[model samples]
Target: MECRFPSVPGAERILSDEALAFVAALHSRFGERRRALLAERDRRQARFDAGERPDFPTDHPGLSDPEWRIASVPDDLKDRRVEITGPAERKMMINAFNSGARVFMADIEDALSPTAENIIRAQINLYDAARRTISYRDPATGKDYALGDKIAVLKVRPRGWHLDEAHLVIDGERVAGAFVDFGLHAFHNAQALIDAGSGPYFYLPKLQHHEEARLWADVFAFTEEWLGLAPGTIKATVLIETLPGAFHAEAILYELRQNIVGLNCGRWDYIFSYIKTHRKDPGAVLPDRAAVTMTVPFMRAYALHVIKVCHRRGAHAIGGMAAQIPVKGDPAANEEAFAKVRADKEREAGDGHDGTWVAHPALVPVAKEVFDRLMPAPNQVDRQREDVVVTQADLLTPCDGPKTMAGVRMNVNVGIGYLAAWLSGRGAVPLHNLMEDAATAEISRTQLWQWRATGTRLDSGETVDAALIDAAFHAEVEALREALGEEAFAVGHYGAAADLMRELVQADELADFLTSVAYERHFAD
Candidate 1:
């Protein structure tokens, strides 16, 4: 198999001939299947646009079987009380590894800016992280950083199936992004992790069907065999981040049952999925992003449903992300932020979730404190949520509240601000005291587009239309420019972001992924 990619700094060490072989092999076996599944996603979207609401999935064979369970996870994975997540950048990885959380999810998907450089950096950084040799020294401060004696368990999240890796072209085409992320790490570091008593653990993202789970299962099976590892050596937790995914929660677990360890409530993307899935429907227009809390009826149902399905299948039910960051110098605001985090973690722990995710390391102890008090056990997998009975209506219910000018402005500013940073090679940016990633960025842009498409009337009685979108868009651009200052704003990717934002909000149809558009327009180098 032939491979072509830019020779970045760590290219030689990370993408050795053997590793390239593994990548090519996986792509050869599963590349066509990946495209087919993505197409299926489009077909499903068309069905929804044609007025068919998402229904509860009950077609899989294992949904009715009560005795079956997911395969047992390795020892280190058992007690994921709190997990800290960030991009696989050096210092961030070290901090997350030493955050005292039970697990650290080094995210190469939503949490990473997948420029060719960042992609190569992540692979090298993760390889070093797996071997416990990653370190960094700040050029400005000269402060050296390394892993702690007692580090968190390592997990990696690859990009979704819908993405393609432009940097690495195989057979005259871009390989599936997920394959490169999962393959390079697994090829170079899987054995090392296993030799150190931990397997190649992963968090699968953006799955919308059980068959996608099945494809991943096959990939896992093949990797284990090719690497001469035992069956079930590769354990994964699927993120129920899509509306269709929440509907088929049980079936998805069953598809990957032999090698799967759990399911996660990816709340941010799930919200985006809800809007995207129902983009053409006026009735599903959501209100302010702040108004859509986890306790809302539909989100609550989805979270509880994930817990129920995972626990019943004897798998861990990981909770959603606490994206709040501690604001410096504003004690009152910080207290309010911590209070929100406390309440959110309490809800998850009290609801029988085994663990949860926190964005910043400061919030790690905050979340761990909640879970430590609520869940004494390492995991709550044994606690079957029997009373969790979710229906189509409960799962499909959108939040009812005000869609205000405030909401529109927020959507526009965040859309441009986050995208500007993202195009400059930063995936996770703290805006307004909260960590913003691709998932949250998706929410920002999609909400604007959805509101615009639906002509959603705000509580202020202004109907969302072309004029309103333009007003909000231009205002947010200028506001971001002023707020960020002249020099900073000039170098920012605001122009490109605004261009994409305009395309998205004014399009006759909603775009699927905001990152995809930005990836093409800005990452053409």
Candidate 2:
């Protein structure tokens, strides 16, 4: 018997092809199994999409009473240094802690290998050591006494994404308050932490988008309900270390406002993110390995972005960690490096950042010293009216038409130079063949006010009010126009000038720009 098939040219051609023939043969051999496999994949994907937490086991116990609570540190200890280690690593922790740091985070996440048994043993040792009064003989006096709270913070590794071996074991046990890292995804081990009665608080890492922040909020909300914790108790500190996060910092903070305690600049991950994000661009030729120094532009941008975002949201803007420090053997190099760190801290404090972080215990005293030196006394700059100031000079200078781009270039150069000088605490520095401290106290007020309007945090650790911010905007616009009088007219650059005016009108943009400039100035050296 002969069978007749459809006469469609395209379909017939496909069937005649060798590749199709082989595919058909394979399907005939295992089509049922393939269909079942596809269905299973879809089922798993659907579960994932439906917000089902994956069944990953954790050794950490569920919270007996889950509640949202803010962790507090002593005021004097706020500026102190911290060390990271456990009892097994006690010597290292003691060495670092005694050097100068105010706190110690017994690190089991990045520093230790992912061995379930080992991790459990370390946690037990850490818990036991922290609960008891530790004594160390003072090398100088050869005397033994209880080490004054040898550790301030205890950090635990709660089985990260790739760490599926169940390294974290809780066994229904509770230790005095300790901080845990929820590594990468919030929904992954969140329920476990809550179930074990571990607080809803966590250190969130590698946050890339505002949606991710929102996702964290949602997960916290779910975990709170599931574990019966208070609504706002699930505090989080986002690790802003990606290019997307850098750009959308304001959005992220705005979305996760109440739940976040602060934002931190993760230098190493940020460098890696910068490389990964921009590697495709031929013009951006970056070095093979990111140097530990802060000279890179993107690095500065990331740092400043964190400050701007945190300050805007009334949260702490903790600076990046000064990871490298000179050891005791090299006093001169140590002092120089320490001095540089202090200078950087001073600049951050001056820019109105809340605080900064350092990895080494020895660097803490220097960090605190710099922070203390730079921050202005509370309420030094007062609220003022925008219309009170009058100036004939135009704050905005327009770039000339395409035909005379050179004139536009000159205008840009002059404007930037003036702005730079004004920012450098040298607004009165001589330039253009003239010497004058042209920047007045009013100008200083205007600059600071402009920065404050951006929702930048004040030294008092509060977000600036919108009304005062608006007043500052107008004042800066007037002052900038006065500063650029004839130069604004020379290039016929009214449009550019107007845009600048508009930017100064908005506090957020102004704050971001000012902070970026500050970072560049401090670390660009």
Candidate 3:
């Protein structure tokens, strides 16, 4: 109903009267319930703080029907052997669609820093992308870019329900960011995609509970009704990335059964959630971020169980990300990165995952090669993992490894670097040859907080306290300054990022998400 900054040019096209009306209708209908669900998160968190552990819903009716299955998926969505994810920036969009993957998920969430300009720009690109009219040229290099005849299927990821778009005010309240991203695109591009023999496809991120999934289902149903489309026109794959959300996989699939197609194992955020959900439990302190691989007891259990539950319910069980980016001009380093990605993708393929994600375009073929060689079919949904049985305790199994000073240094360095880039208008950034997004940075921040709060003892007998944290931060900052010259470091947002990181890691309680605090403090319209 209102714009926070009306003077921002190009706002008119995205915020046209009809678009605003649709978004406002969505907000007016579901805004209060969205707020209630968010409050439910705090309530559930309070229980976790009070020593109540999360468990699967025992009374869910959907589990009673062993024959129940989600509606059949679209033909294009089947055979998603390799999927690529990136922010909806112009160049990234063009490249990702042409990345030779089955699906290119244009993420407007963690992979994107939610600036007003960025959100509007993403929506505009999605409009063009749906119609295959998207194009670009290198202003500096004089090179041209356009969509090829064959491109990866476009699936958009809107911001999670926990976020709001400060730039778009509707009915005197800041509209949900999810509504803006989903509403604008679905409003503008759904019919075009339908006409093209495709429909509005989406990847829902950061759902901590099945109720959240239920809310999304309601949103999708309402959108279809609003747009005069058939039921189940919108298809989504939920990312079972949170510790709590993983426990409710059956219920989540049940809630979105009408429009649901698959479930993805999100590694980074699930680890982060494991730390945050158990932040108050001293025994749950994890090891170095790198040490906690998908093979860990809990992660392994969840990954296998996802395959079991998804296949049982006739949905595709997508695997986690291969975040390793290819390095140029250094054959050895590039080989090492390639090896890591290959191993990860192979494990996913062998474990009966339908597909896996790659952060960069170059790694698409690398992932595809693994799936293509091993799978030899469109999908393996028939491989019911009945032999794989994971229990409540198994899903919550504690990680085991050594906590060291090196781990602390890496966390501090990566956290600051990511925050600096996120504040500088980039959501997905390259750090140490890997693509770092909000989810990865979350692992850094939450791990640091858990260590400090529990006074974790490092390999060198050093206790994780405020002093040790400050020391690590300072050491990493100086190292970064030398690595990236003083002039560049001084001009960047590293200073503000440092100040914010200190406040976050030093807080008495762990924050839910670093982006939440950062967006409100700095990037808010």
Candidate 4:
């Protein structure tokens, strides 16, 4: 096994011959299956676009089986009340581990820009973090950073099935990003993590069907046997982020029963999925992103159903990201943000969620306070949520809020801003006081496409058409340029980002994901 990929800093240390061999083995064994699954997704999506509505199957086999249960939740993963999520960047890696949260989700999927250096270096960070040797020193300030006595339990989130690792090729074919991430981390650190009182864990993303979950289960099984580990040593939490995935939550859990421990209400991606899945439905138009809070009817139904399904199968029901970063100097604004975070977590806790996620460390205490007060036990998996029932109507109900012109401007502004930041190798960006990532970007751009496709009407009595949307896009870009000034805008990939955002929003057809195109053309090495 000779490797031919481009190198990164400390690449040899992370990508040893044995590790590369392990990754290659996984690629060879599962690569074809992954390609088939992705193609299946396109086929299903095409059927959906041609007016086939998605609904729960009436002949859902064995749904009434009362005896099947998922594997037991490991101790380190049992209390995930405050899981802080971010990319596995070096400084962020050290900070997140010591952030005092119960669990830290080192995300390589939506929260990370999949640059070559980023993909390889992230594995190195996780390897070092697992060995308790993670540290970083700011070269400019000479500030030393190291892990603290108190640290969060680490869980890795691999890229979704839709993505591929262009930097890693095995047998003259590019490997799936999920395989590279999972194979490397599991190969290098699974046993060491188990030795240190934890186990290899993952949060699966963007699963559109139970078959995809089944694919992941098989991968876990194969990896464990190949690595000489126990069959169920690896546990996974599936993100019910798509409409089809939400409807098939029970089936998905069943497919991965032996290696499943939890289900997350991946709220942002769910919104994006709603738009993509229902783009052709004239009545499926969503309101402004601001108005589409978790309290909306569709969102509420999805959240409750996920909790119900997870608890029914003896697994944790984790809530989605709060995405609130505390304000520094403004006391009133900070108080309002804290109040919102507290309320969201309280709702999740009261509704039978075992744990929840926060994006920033500052909001950790707020989230922890809510869950701690509500959950005195390790988890609330015992709460079966028998009273909550979600019908297909409930999940598809549109909000009553109006889609306004201001909403159009906001989407273009934030969408372009996030794209610039993403193209510059930053995935998690703070814009207009909100922490945004690929999920938000996905929603921003997809919503624009959806509105245009459906001829959505704004509150100002204007229908969404190409001319109106195009003008909004250009106006927003010029405003952003002025706001960022010549120097700051010129320093990054803002020019390319503006063009890409405009092309995506103004095109006749919607792209599956903006990053899929952006990564291939701009970031992939």
Candidate 5:
């Protein structure tokens, strides 16, 4: 494929003669670099594949053993009356620790300014805060001295690709590390956290491809060897925000399977991605200032995809942030906001999401309440039927009907795509019907696996075989083509999904007809 750069104002254009010469020279240099990188990667992968004594740290020394457990908040805290931090912006970290969240991510990537010096200072303060007890005043009462311990905190640094001169400071000192981008940085940060007597865990952001995820695992292995951390000690929660990442959700999850602890839907970034991906005609895409509602169908699909992916992996599928609440406000307004937050939490819980994040400390109580009500306690398994049950009281209940054989087919096809992508080591692929968009193979496979295990009843069913799945997938693709037209299958500019499907088919690693069906479904346009 020819590389076409996006047209930016004032961008320089090369003359034909200069461009040809430059291309030749660039190719020669790039070929050598690529060869060396690939050779090194292979050498490292060999050691990893052989399960040789890893050079980096693993849970081998019991570093992953929890040294401290934060106290659980009371049910009343769910009323959203608790306040963790002061009103100042800097207080966000302190507030989160006090707000009763099980995990507090000191975000240096997205939430904070992308300046390296500021990031280092923030990290140092956060580290200092984590090691000591802090006090805050009670907002409700005129009381002073409400003591609180630091919660489980994790620091997220900018990815190597995005890091400028600003991301070099760690504890006021320059730390030499490759800034590969979010996926790689996550593993690197996990290693750093583990080395610093903290847990090996992180919240990864801006992930767009399944290959990126596999690369993360590779980097994690490298970090483990470098730092002497245990394998499987570092866990990550990937933020599903961008259009590419959304479609590739299943692939990413599958690649990072055991290492992933949670999956989060990033609503804002996703909205931006959707605008960029779908609005082919620049004029049709809305302006940056447009106010689009978050409740659109695409957003819902993205959210549902995240939830499905996490559930399949038995990992936590965390809901998006509710940043609408005020940090401090009128009592009545605050009460109303808290009430609304409570309702939102109830809805998410009903939808099967394990937990959610809140930007304000004041919102934590309400958030936690919703999670507690929805989540089965660690000790409380099998309290309900194994089927996908939805009481009338549940907010998002499955429609009542005899299971549609067509729906079953769709699920089965989705499963084949999942298995094929996994076998081929792809993160995501286009769905059978939607050539313009893609779904994570992991998500499709998980849904199929769940459906088969649970049965086709409105509430639950049992698992189907690979044969059934393959048949269903092909059928769905055909049905979709008939509905959306052949052109719908044409992903004019999107190559990741098509390329991945092609690789899977060419390799024939999956079931015989699986790749063929996917290719026709995704590329027949």
Candidate 6:
């Protein structure tokens, strides 16, 4: 069959004939199943909306096997005490590798704006990094940026299954964004990565079920066979970021056991998913975004459950991101933020998590220091967390925090600010001194949806409804406009962002992903 690989300007370096064919081959093999799985997601959401609550699947055969364990993890992944995550863009890629973390999660999904240029450029960057030939120079300062003498292990995150690469088409169908990212890297750099003392490692994002994991494992098997490499040449870590993914963590690991190495409690996206999965339940309404910290009951249950399940199955349990960037000029604020990061990492390590994530290079040492003290070894998988028991009630336990009008205003500000930055080609944004990603925006918009749906009362003695939210949103916009000035605000796409934010939060139908909707309307060609 003929393959029609769509062309994007400056994509030629990565889109070699063989690479395009590799992607096309994957599409031909698994595209239909990918579509079917997405359809299943819609069906499951429908059922949930119809009052079916998520419980452990009754028919999963692995649940009955008390003695089964995942395969031993590879050496490179064993000591993931501190990992840094960032976009796959060129400069960010160079900076993260030099961040002194044990692993660098090169993200093409949530942390990146999936513009066609960005996607293709990211592939090229990964290829260069794998070849140890990646370097950059500042256009203005002439400062050279390159790999450090000491570098972190590289783990690339492809776009989630829900995203389609509109720039890449074959047989009159757009290619799955996941396949495009995975295929190019696997084709051009998999062996090169192996030669550099690492393999083609990955962090699978937004998996809703074990079947989706099964599809990825199948892709790995096929790619290995097609490339004449040994089976299991790839290792994957599933981000248990969805409510469904959290419920079936063990089954997910089991499905990809031969090639799966770990599971990360992606806290932000999990919160977003929690709100989204139960948007209809008045009982499921969450408190203010800031109030709903990891120490909250439901989040705590999830963290403990993931650690227990991962340790029981002989895989690594990685912790979530501390998204605070250290303050530049304020020493006291930096100290305070560092203290919070230290405390958070200490808790994760104490709970038997093998590693944790940080968003900025500056915070890497803070996270590393905590793990270094608590974990004398590479990991604490032997801890087993046998005493940690989680029930469905625990997972479903509502957060016990007060909702406030201040939190509402903060959400409106951060959501619109992030969307504006995202629409302007920046994905990882800093708003109110916190490093905000798509997950952060998801929480903001989803909270807006839930608060409006449930008419949640805020601490100010006012019930949250459409009018209240709209007023807050407009107020935040005017405030931003005044702060940013006319020229800056106009260039920031604040108006478009405001429209998009309202559409997402106030729409009759909830969107599964803000990026998925925004990408088609604004970013896609």
When 2 and 4 are scored with lDDT, the better candidate is 4
Please give the range of 10 consecutive residues that has the lowest summed lDDT in model 1: 1-10
What are the runs in model 3 whose C-alpha is more than 4 Å off? 5-10
Q: Which candidate is the best by lDDT?
A: 3
Write down the worst ten-residue block by lDDT for model 4: 57-66
- lDDT for each candidate structure: 0.90, 0.41, 0.91, 0.88, 0.44, 0.90
- For residues 368-476, what per-residue lDDT tens digits would candidate 6 score against the true structure? 9999999999999889887888888888868878798888988888899999999998899987778889999999999998898888888788998889988998899
lDDT of 2 by residue, 469-512 (tens): 44544454455567667566334443343344334434343221
Looking at model 3, report the run of 10 residues with the lowest lDDT sum. Answer: 2-11
Residues 225-313, candidate 5: write the lDDT tens digits.
54566666656677887655665665676667656665677665565444333322222232111133334444555566566555554
Q: Judging by lDDT, tell me the better candidate of 1 and 3.
A: 3
RMSD of 2: 23.3
**lDDT comparing candidate 6 with the true structure:** 0.90
lDDT of 1 by residue, 414-468 (tens): 8888888898899999999999899888998888888888878899888999998
* TM-score on alpha carbons, each prediction: 0.98, 0.46, 0.98, 0.98, 0.49, 0.98
Query: In lDDT terms, how accurate is model 2?
Result: 0.41
Provide the global lDDT of candidate 4 against the true structure.
0.88
The TM-score between candidate 4 and the true structure equals: 0.98
Query: Can you tell me which runs of candidate 4 are displaced by over 4 Å?
Result: 1-6, 58-62
| TM accuracy, model 3 | 0.98
Candidate 2 weakest ten by summed lDDT: 390-399
Residue 495 C-alpha lDDT in model 4? 76
Q: What is the lDDT of residue 242 in candidate 2?
A: 57
Superposed by TM-score, candidate 4 places the C-alpha of residue 303 at a distance from the truth, in angstroms, of 0.4
lDDT of 4 by residue, 1-525 (tens): 435455876789888888888888888888899999889888888998898877775555525676788977898888888899999988987888888899989999988988888888899899998899999999999999999998999899999988988877766788888988999999999999999999999989999888898899999999999899999999999999999889899888988999999899999999999989988888788999899999999999999999998988898999989988878899999899889999999999999999999988888889999988999898888888899989998988788797999998888888888888888889999977678899888898988888888888898999999899889987887786887898888887777887898799888788999999999898665
Residue 399, candidate 6: alpha-carbon lDDT: 83
